[model samples]
Target: MKFLVDAQLPVRLARFLESAGYDTIHTKDLPHKNATSDTEINSISIRDNRIVITKDSDFLNSFLTIKEPYKLLLITTGNINNLELEAIFAANLQFLSELFVSHSYIEMTRDSIIVHY
Candidate 1:
């Protein structure tokens, strides 16, 4: 599935996703960059059919409360460097790649991915 990597995540994640063959974009590419509002991000995700990969709990709140984005991959890996974070995603490629097809929300830690509906 396609993905939109939020500002809190390093832009490297977006590059990694693209190299892995999934359509992906980082918030840095948007006009507002880090200042982009959640509402606008949601709108973009909806318009583009992109799942949001974010470290922000606000996205989780929006999803739980009102289902804002098309889907979510909430990174709960906690303050990790880009290389390690990229490693976790790469190692979990099979799961991460297929996750959005059947799940709307997923919490991903360094060790495991938990699907939440």
Candidate 2:
């Protein structure tokens, strides 16, 4: 799976995904850096077939209203530190990998993952 980590999320998460053998790119790596606009990100995601991993509700709103970006993983574990967030991702990525095979939208909290097909 390919992932485009959003500005709000840590780059370490992208590194972790990359280390796991997935193609991953954090916003910090983008030419525009973390300032890259959502539309541009969406365009890139669609063109590259990358799943957007974000904390922004605007992406979900865009997905709901326009169905762009192709796929999304919305991290809903609010207010967690970067270490905790990365830990959660590392721990649950295996479970999520299965869901990604059939689902396009996933919301992961501190305790559980909800998949939307």
TM-score of each model, paired residue for residue: 0.96, 0.95
User: Which lDDT tens digits does candidate 1 get at residues 1-117?
Assistant: 789999999999999999999999999999999899999999999999999999999999998999989898899988899999999999997886777778899999989989986
RMSD of 1: 0.8
- Clash count per candidate: 0, 0
How many Å off is the CA of 13 in candidate 1?
A: 0.7
| Model 2 per-residue lDDT tens digits across residues 42-96 | 9999999899999899999999889877799999998999889988988998888
Off by over 4 Å in 2: none
Worst 10 residues of 1 by lDDT: 93-102
Scored against the true structure, residue 11 in model 1 reaches a CA lDDT of 92
